[model samples]
Target: MPQEFSRTERVADYLQQELAKLLLHSVRDPRAEFVNITAVDVSRDLRYAKVYYTKLGVESAEAATDVTRVLDKAAGFLRTEVAKGSSLRTVPKLTFKFDESVGRGRHMEDLLGRARASDALRGNEAEADDS
Candidate 1:
């Protein structure tokens, strides 16, 4: 019978939890202070993992770049910490990536708000004309 969760999936989930704790308490860089781990994707061989992260109150490209730089520089240390905390024989290399989904969602919300406001205005104007 096949396992309910593959080794890679298990590793990815473990890494995500450990990394979140590490980022929250271990990392001290100001750029990474607000970093939130959005998702973790581990390779089937468990040799590499891509960590998606986002920063609070960092919307500009320059700010995002700075956060990414800090996280990437600290990847080695993070990986070492993960190795010490987990029972895995090999800890996957960490790659830091800025996740833009949050920002995209905010933008979508703004667009939706504008659309709704416009529709309401049109409805109001139509009612005024009908009266």
Candidate 2:
């Protein structure tokens, strides 16, 4: 027999994989184009699953409520499909959250690049002035 993963871990894994797949092709909503699930967290009792996601190419990156509505609409379908392979007693409810870490990281990198350029320009000016 295969080793059984903990309930929470299994749920998390299922949500991550299944939701990712569902978002790729099954979902018909235009709003989903900018959304991508980054991570999933399932409750110990399998009552809830928190999905961390990010918005790509969208201004303001929207909010959790946006994903929540999509998740709410998709939950029944996700649960039904997830239950097909999972032996767990219950499939947790899906809750989507906007994960901004990706955007934040890109912003930080841009800031660093600008700082480096400024420093280089300053160094060049100082050397010119000393000549």
Q: Give TM per candidate.
A: 0.93, 0.80
Question: What does candidate 1's lDDT look like per residue over 69-97, in tens digits?
Answer: 88889999999998888788999999988
Q: What local distance difference test score does each model get?
A: 0.88, 0.77
Residues 29-55, model 2: lDDT tens digits:
877766778899988777888888876
Clashing residue pairs for model 2: none
> Using alpha carbons, what is the TM-score of model 1?
0.93
- Candidate topping TM-score: 1
Model 2 ranges with Cα > 4 A deviation: 1-7, 59-67
Q: In angstroms, what RMSD does candidate 2 have relative to the true structure?
A: 3.3
